[model samples]
Target: MNNITKEITPLTQNDCFTIFSRVKKEFNFPLHFHEEYELNLILNAKGAKRIVGDNVEEIEDMELVLVGPNLSHVWLTHNCKSEEIREVTIQWHKDFLDEKMLKRNQLSFIRRMFDRSTKGILFPRETAQLVYKRLLVIDQMQGFDSVLELMSILHQLSTAKSMRVLSDATFNNDQVLNYHSRRIDKAFEYMNANFHKPVALKDLAKLVNMTEVSFSRFIKRRTGTTFIDSLNEIRLGHATRMLIETTHSIAEVSFNCGFNNISNFNRFFKKKKNCTPKEFRENFSGTRVFI
Candidate 1:
């Protein structure tokens, strides 16, 4: 696998498409938004507020949320601190399912659910568990079976009793579109371009036309994370993508993610994922080293 870069971009693009999704995480990062529809189901985890689109609430176990294309959302996994590991995630392209079939008599309810997701949608615990069981099978299957399984999951979500649309922000929420609300799009763009290197707070502050102190407060409020937190999030994100999509040694993946040495990388990886890089790769491929 190619070395991953640590630089955080205003927007992360994978071959022209914005990357969206997470598999399992020991803990998630602060608030970040991207250009993709997002559906998340986290089981047996507790956390503080997750600002899905514009709606905010305290998060609890068996939580489920669906956000539309370009909508802003955050899941606060930091609040939960336990030795036990328990989490799951399932996200896909907005058009993963056929569009015309969305409204083809049988799926109108599901289509309506998609429309409602433009704001954001949440499922009650009972409803989430029912769909969660189906979703586990969906993630494990491939080809036509996967498609059918996903449809089944959607159908279940659409009919949940305590279902709710979360965000009240417009489809054109500036906050979602490059932090336009804070007028920091340029700063964000530059950050992504040069995150791999040391970026002084003063330099980033100037880029956004603010003093360091003001910029610090502004960013933390905007994204619910400090600057360093955001930077590490980018590094880990790149590492995770490479782990899932490519074949590379753990040492190589660590360097690609901007770790200066193996020891630090191992610690960070284990902290964030509750597993080492080698274990991550092994779990995904179902392969183990006998040695």
Candidate 2:
């Protein structure tokens, strides 16, 4: 798997957010996370793999996504053969919209949108196309006009009807709770450490000092997913990273991700990702290895 690392993206002194529009021949960034919120737009890069926290998928000709602070993400030039790849990236501090600012009635939707973005959010094609056009001209504005345009862009995104949340439940557990529940925190800590093994629901229930039924209901209420589904999501998260970063065979990857049988692994992967493991791996170009 690629060595997931933290990156520090530099920002300018006077700007609340920094924006960049670049035309590059290749996407060579490693799998990394940063402290700032990011809105990225990519054009003319089809069949590229987009890795956001525990989620992995292929992008089409144009893609737009909002990634929250410290969420690992990267776009690799998988099958794209474009001579010039157009990309626009906007980065802002996590506190750019403070709690007080978000509490305002007018910003309620944007606040909720930002919260959901703790697990990366992908805008649909129509919204993407609309924002893509706006982004193309944003660099031309200056001072207050620039800030206004950016706010307009965010408002448009906040109202979009069909955005997809990319990462799985495990990836958002910590962010969603914000250390509010110690028991849930401990449960996640244990799960992260032992997900590669056959973790029993009874064992987990006991660890949290509850019966199996009560524990199941508690977890479902907290995470909006069943215990088994959450465990599989954690395993699949690791499996996807392995598939992208390692040369291991599907069987080996499955076993390493705690699946004892290949058939069961294949079934679970297809159900979650809508594609077979082999096809997912093949979506990326053979030449690009981001480690």
Candidate 3:
């Protein structure tokens, strides 16, 4: 990650949300994060690279994603050559939805969806097609009615099927680590705390009171990734932050993140970020967008 910018969104403290719609020739925003939650819709941008946390993918012609507060993301022009691109962005404060309101029976589904958005959520094509028109018109309406309409859109999206989580579960430190199991929580807590040191599956299994083999299976089932992969993700997350906030040498960053060797660290970092650590730092040092 380059010195990823932190965007101060236009939503005032008193506003429920803000929407921006545009027809543009290209995507130019820098990789950035914000304190507000964002729902962004883009059309005619196939081949554009979408980066959300540690996940990066070439977007389709039509795409929609919900990015949680402070999660790094950006859409780059890449191979997208479309002269007419349509984009709609909606941003809201973190406290826009009351905690108690989200817990209600009518809003439980939205609550769970919001929780998953911490990693960024990619709506399927069908859902994106269904919601894009609504998003486009949302800014035109005013007052309390517009807020209700936005809620309606979220409700529809919440119930939509097959929305995929786009980033690693442990990529964001502030993300709630809830696996609904005490053992899983404990294991992750330990991993996050000691990710900068040598850690092994056997040690983690013992800490969670399980045999090595059983612990491996349990973690795989709970997080959909093996123990080693999960640990690597944690290390990579910290490494990204360090890259942005520190002037340490690339070798230092690699070693301090617990990678035993520079080669292995470079391999993993490139695989996750699509660029070398040095390239990432240089990119961030050049230009940035405050939007």
lDDT (C-alpha) at residue 42 in model 2: 92
Better of 1 and 3 by lDDT: 3
Tens digit per residue, CA lDDT, model 3, 165-206: 999852553322335688987987787788779999999999
Ranking by TM-score: 3, 2, 1
Candidate 2 global lDDT: 0.78
Candidate 2 per-residue lDDT over residues 1-291, each given as its tens digit: 236644434342234877767787688767877667899999989888899989989889988999988788899988889888888888877767788999999998899889889899999999998788888777777777878888889989999999989988424323233324677767766776786798999988999999999999888877666888767776776787678769999999999988889999899887666567898787644321111
- How do all the candidates rank in terms of lDDT, highest first? 3, 2, 1
Return the TM-score for candidate 2, rounded to 2 decimals: 0.58
Best by lDDT: 3
For model 1, the stretches where C-alpha displacement exceeds 4 angstroms are 1-26, 171-243, 249-291
Say which candidate scores most in TM-score.
3
| Residue 234, model 3: Cα distance from true site in angstroms | 31
Clashes of each: 4, 1, 0
TM-score for each candidate, following the candidate numbering: 0.54, 0.58, 0.60
Better of 1 and 3 by TM-score: 3
Candidate 3 achieves a global lDDT of 0.81
- Name model 3 segments beyond 4 Å from true: 173-291
